[model samples]
Each structure stands twice: as structure tokens, then as C-alpha cells.
Target: MDERVATALGEAFPERAVDRTFGVGPSWNGANETVGVAFADGERAFCKVAVAGDGSRIARELAVLRYLDAERSIAGPGVLAGDPDADLPYLVTAPAPGRELLGVWEDAGDDENAGEVEREALLRRVGATLATLHAKRFETHGEIVGTDRGGGLALDPAPWPDVLRATIERTREIGTSERLADHYDAAFDCVEATRGRLEGAPAALLHGDVAKPNLFVSDGDGSDPAVGPDGIVPIDWELAHVGDPARDLVRAEDQLLNGFDSEGPARYADALYKGYRDRAGGLPPGFAERRPIYEVVRMLGRSGFIDQWVTYLDEPLESLVDRADAELRARLDAV
Candidate 1:
């Protein structure tokens, strides 16, 4: 167990004994650590603590979970205990109900998982779920600094472009290394140059990182027992914020379908978008116009985490670096 996690569990459950701790899975964010905990009395929960002693992510997640619990109909993990301001900031929550969407999506190729048909339905549900969340509109865009007294988001208001740039800075804080340092500069330049196009975007709540691993679906074979009305539940709200719905949709498609070496099958991407379109009454406004810049921004996910990608792909660092460089440049040129 991580020392911080152990300390947090001790604080959160002063009267109980812990039976064991287990790994949740690989996470790309380097600032925080999360683990699944089993108590001696038989209850289980997940504990996340900031390893760098910076509590912003903890605060963001805690506030988002509280907001979801109070306002949103969708199911999110119930907060068990947390204090983002503590010496060792941490948040504990009951485990999200269901299996990870990553496993189900990956196993869709297998005969037993009912193949691409099932996977397509899953991605569609993902798109619809995002649409449901994005339907909650905000008057202005900004970072979710915390919650208001009324149990709503306390946003530090900024223009949409500034808010988007702030997210890039936050990603840099958590994931960037010296190897692709210039890529960050280039991304900033791209966002700055496209400021005119990015203004006046719809202000909807976006799950900034929409990777399959952050989503969950019920264990039931049918969709009826799914965690939320849209038949999917999302975890890890640290990146949640108010932003352009189109940005979230673009990120969702990329995160859900793209691979290290290539973009995954086009049909799957289509299915995901189709689901979003079916729910949103068409794609979010400006989806096509703003997509290129968002694509340029999304390149940071690869460039900023090149080393992790090298390990994830089990390929030579030099080769991955070359590929990521080429890809980032290509995306910038497209914008």
C-alpha cells in the first residue's frame, strides 16, 4: 500500500482494520495514486491520494462527485470520506458498480463476447451517456474550482479559449516530460491562433478524459441493469469541467477508439458518433468546425506521455518518439 493511502485509510476509518489493498489498473496521471481497499469487516472502497501533496485534483474530484450526487441523475461512486485540504489529501469512495468498459471493448473481438456488434452497442451507449451529461448547460465556461454553497459547481469564470488552454496547462503539470517539451509550446500556439474560432462555444460539462478505462458498464448481459439511464457510468471526475460539448465528443471518440500505432476501425468511430447524434438531436453545435483544433490539442495525450506510450506499445523509445513527433506535427498542420 502507498504510505499516503495507508495514512488516508487510517484517517477515514479510524475504528476499522483493513484486510488488504490491491492495484486498480494503470493510470497515466503521475500526480495521484489510487488503490482498491478491502476492510476486515468486509466492506470495500477505493482510495486516491495525491502523491505530490498537491490537492487540486483531489479537490476537483471530490467537488465533482458531490455535485453529481446532488444534481445529476447518472450514477457515480458514492463518496465515503475525503478532505482535499488535509496534510495528505485523499478521497475515498465506494467502488463504482460494474466492470470496466476497457475490458469489454477489448474482448469484443473474441467469440464469447459477441464480437463487434456488442462493442458497437457499447460505444453507442458511451456516446449517449456523454450526451446526457453534456445536456446540463452552464452560462459561462471555467475551471471547476470547487462546489458552491447551493451544491452546484463553483466555477472560476474564463472565456472558453482560456479555459481550454488551462486544461492543457493542467495536463502538462500532471503528464509532460522534457522529451516533447516543444510540442506543448506548439499546442499553445495552435490554441492561441485559433482563439477566434473557439470563442462562444456551448458551455456544457465535459469529462475531460473519456478513455474507456474511466467508464463502467453493468455485469449484466443485457442493458437493462446498467448503472445509469444511458446504460453506462463514468468514474474519475478529476478532469471534469464546463466546456464545449464538441470538445468532449471529439476527445471521447479518440480515447474510445484510437490505438497507439493507428486509429482503430472507422466503423466503431461511426457508431460512437451515431450514438451521440441520436441523443443530442444531431452532433453538438460546431462539432465539425472545432474538431481540428481539438485534434491538435489531443496530440498532447501522445506527445506529453511518450515514455508511457513506449512502454504501453512495447516498442523502441526512438521509434515511438519519431512517430509521436510526426503525428503531432500532422495534427498542427491540419489546424
Candidate 2:
């Protein structure tokens, strides 16, 4: 444990003695850096601390959780207490139940038929949860958090395009195979062509990162031994913002398609559209036309040459860049 974390916890709850416990389970989510520690009272909680000056991230997360807590419609980790004044901004919350959907999907592994069935059910649950969130009157903590009247949270949109461009440049710089090179080129072109179209889309409250890992499931103890059907609990609202709803939906769709190999891309893509429509009432105009472009944007946004693809591939950086270039070219051809 970092000495800073221990001291911060002591200050936050001055009356209680804090002991580090090894028996506590590890964190199952990826939203932020949190240490899993069991308190002396036998309560298991996650301790999330941010450096004092970097309180915005923790503040934003706390605000979202507080807003959700008030609504009481969705299942999320309940915030126990938080303080931003200490050397570390800290929050303690009861852990929510569920296995990360990515792990579940991976465990289902190459069992195609079984994976497809499970994936569909998971998709429906996710769709329903999202629908509930979107249906609520756009209110949060009784204040409008954005320019829109819906009270959705706001974030500067200026960084997204630059973020996308930097991702592409990084991938290209890393270098990869001919095939990936082609794909990267094609993806870049698609981005350039459709960038203008997305500018006009209406902004709504979006779960900034809606990938599979953030969707969790818990199982009920029963003879059936299957995962509970109440639906997935969406975790991590740190990136929640008033932005293009399509960005959120498309991000989820891309994860279901490209990130998971259990089902064919087109099949999963169709399933996502169906799920989104069931909740949102209808697809946005030109949804089909815009999907390919959005996929490119999402791919670029997620590509971290050093952290994810290149390191996982265990190849030379130049080779990784080459592969990305080829993949972009191929994706562009399809577009």
C-alpha cells in the first residue's frame, strides 16, 4: 500500500483504526485506480484516491454517483464517503456485484453457439439498462450540467478530433504489416470524409466508455446456476458527459463486434442496432451510413500503440505500425 493512501484514509475517517487486509478481493472494474481494502469492521470497500490537485476526475465521478444515487433507478456502487481536501481526494464505496462481462465473454471463449446465446442475452440486458438511463428526465443533482436543458453533463469536445489524429499518427509511427497498413489508411480516409457529418448530431448524456469490460453481471444462487437476469450494472461514470449519443452507442457496438471474436462482426453489429432501437425507439437518420465512419473513429480513439496492441503483439514497434497501416487500408476499402 502506498503510504499516501494510508495517511489519507486515516484523515478521512479519523475515529476509526484502519488496518490493511490481504484477504480482500481485487478490483473487478477498470474505471480508476482503487485499492481494495477491508475495514476493521469487516466491511469490504474500494478506496479510490486522487492526488489533491487532480481532484476534477474524482469530483466528476463522485458527482455522477451522487446523481445516480438520487435517481435510484440504476444499480451502482453506493458512495460511502468522500473528501477532496486531503493530499489525496478519496472515496469509499460498497462494491457492486458482477463479473466483468469481458471475462465472462472470454471464458465462454471459442464455444461459438454458447457464446452467441450468452452474448445476445447480455446485449439485451445492456440495452434495457441504457434505455432506462436515457428515458429519465435529463436532470442531475437538480442542476443543468450542460448547455442542453436536459441537465446532462458537459465536456469540452475540442480534444476528441485531436485525440483521434494523435492515435492514428502513433499507430503509423509504430509501423506494422502490409495488411494493417492498408486498413489504417482506409480508416483514416473514412474519418476525414465523415468528420463533418457528425458535427450536427444532437448531444445527450453519454456513458463515455461503454466497452464490454464496464458491463458487469452477478449470478443468483439457484439450481439453474446461470447468471442473474435482472440485467447488467453499468459501472464507471467518470467519463459521463453530454456528448453525441451515437458515440456511446457506436463504442458499445464496436466492442461487441471487433473486440469480441465470439461472433461474426456483421451479426453482432446487427444485434447492437436492434438492441439500441428497442430502447431508443429508432435509429438516428443515416445510422447505417455513419456506422463505418464512427467505427473508424472509435478504433483510433482506443488504439494505444504502447499500452495495448503493440505490447500485446510483442513485436517491434515498426512492425506494429505497419500492421495498423494495413488494417486501416482494408477498413477504408470496406467503407
Candidate 3:
């Protein structure tokens, strides 16, 4: 066990000894570690510790979880013990039942029809879960700093355009490929020209990464007999932020649909929209018009690391860039 985990176990649960520890979930390269701990008293818990970074990421996650726990409507893990401010920040919580949505989705991998049925049902729950998330109010949009005195996030709100430009610029820099570095300036121009679509966007809570792995499916074995329509639980709030709800929802569609396969069924998208629309009342004013642009934005972020996975593709990196470049222009033209 890492010193941080060993020390934390002694401090948090002095009576219980560490049974075993294993790598549990997805983690950024050096940023954090999700560890599973089983105790002598027959209790099991999950702990997330930030081994690197300035602590803001894990701290934000803790704050978000606390807020969700306060709301009590979203079905997620409850914060049993944590110290986001500690030297090696760690959060301990009891695990929710079932498994990751990706694992559940993969069960239908061999059977096409089964995948379709499961995906549609799961997408609907994801949609409703997003509705529950978007219901949490924030005064404005930007990075979440910390908890405010009012038991809400201390937000540093910025104009939506500025946020969009800043994010695009950062992604370009993060892409870090000398081959494509010079061409990214035009991406900035696209955002600069297309800022009108994002103007005056309302701020709301966003589960920044809404892919299959980060979401969980519960059997709903508690007081609620049925798993119900909202059994999906979104985990991993490291990317959670305050932003335009449309941007979040659109990115979610792009992520959840394209995560496993390039072409996911349209009915799954329909199911997701039905869940969000029935709950939120309607789509954002310009979502249909602005969706293509956001799809390009999401594509840019993914393309940044294409070289890492380029080996799997039959075509060269240059080919993917060519297609992405054309798609970018098309999205911009539509705007």
C-alpha cells in the first residue's frame, strides 16, 4: 500500500485493519488512485486519493460529491470519510451495487440485437440522470473553486464565449503534436467567428465526463424495489464544472454514443433526448443548430491524442487530420 493509503486507513478507521488494496477504476496518469479496501468487520469501501496535482481536482470532486449527497436525489456513493484538504487528499465511500455501464454494455458485444435493447434502456437512464444533474443550479459558468458559505460551489463565472475560447486554446496546446501544432490557430478563428451560438448560455452543473466507464448501474435493492428509471449513477467528478448545459449534454451525446463503436444507434440518442426533454421540459434554444459545432469541439479534444492510438488505425495520422479538418470546416460552415 502507498504511504498515503496506509496512513489514511489508520486515521480514518483505526479499529479496522487493511485487508487488501487493488487498483479499482480509471485514473489520470499520475493524478489520482482509486483503491478498494475491505475491512475486518466485513465492510467494504472505495477510496480515491490524489497522489499528484495541486489538490484542486480531487478537492473539486469532494465538494461536488458533498453537494450531491446534500441533494439526496441523485443515486451515487455517499461520502463516508474523506479529507480533500489533507496532504495526500483521499475520499472513502461505500460502493454502489451492480457495475460500470461499460461492463454492462459489453455483455451485448456478441449479440447485436441485445446491444441495441440494452443501450436504449441504458441511454434513457443516462438522460434522466443528466436531467437530475442539470437541475442543480449555479449562479454562473466557469471553474468551480470551492464551497461557498451558502452550501454551494464557489464559482468563478466567465462569459460563455471566453470560456469556450480558453478551453479550445488549451486543448490545442494540450494536443502537443508538432506536426499539427501550427494548424490549430484556425480552430481559434472558428470559435471566434462562431461565438454567437454560445452567447448568454445559462450555467448549470455538468458531469464533465459522461462516458460509459464513469457511469454506474445499480440494481436498486434499497427501499426502492425497482431499479427505476433513474438507476444510473455518474461517478468521477474530476472533470465536473459549471458550464452551459447544452454544451454538457451535447458532449455527453458525442461521448456516450461514440465511446465503444463509431456508429451507435439513433434510438439510443432518442431515448436520451426523451429522458432529458421530459425532465428539463425542452431542448435549449439553439441546440440543434449549435450541436454540430460542439461535436467538432469534442472531436478536437479527442484528436489531440490521436497519435497515441494511431497504431490501431489502418490510415496514417495525416489522414485522420484531413478528415477532421474537413469536418471542422463543415461544422463551421453550418454555424
Q: Which candidate leads the pack in lDDT?
A: 1
Show model 2 residue runs off by greater than 4 Å: 21-32, 84-86, 107-112, 136-196, 219-230, 256-265, 328-335
Error of 3 at 67 (Å): 0.8
Candidate 2 lDDT tens digits, 88-148? 7777776667787778777763778988877776676676556556555332212113222
The number of the candidate with the highest TM-score is 1
For candidate 2, the clash count comes to: 38
Model 1: per-residue lDDT, tens digit, 1-62?
67788899989889889999999988888889999999998999999999988888888899
Q: Supply the global lDDT for candidate 3.
A: 0.71
Worst 10 residues of 1 by lDDT: 219-228
Pick by lDDT: 2 or 3, better one: 3
Q: Compare candidates 1 and 3 on TM-score and give the better one.
A: 1
- Choose 1 or 3, whichever is better by lDDT: 1
Give the runs in model 1 whose Cα sits over 4 Å from its true position.
Answer: 109-113, 219-226
Residue 116 of model 3, lDDT score: 85
List the global CA lDDT of all models.
0.86, 0.57, 0.71
Q: Where does model 3 exceed 4 Å of error?
A: 7-15, 25-30, 108-111, 165-187, 221-229, 259-261, 311-323
TM for every model, in the order presented, reads 0.95, 0.71, 0.84
Span of ten consecutive residues with least summed lDDT in model 2: 139-148
| Model 3 error, position 241 (Å) | 1.2
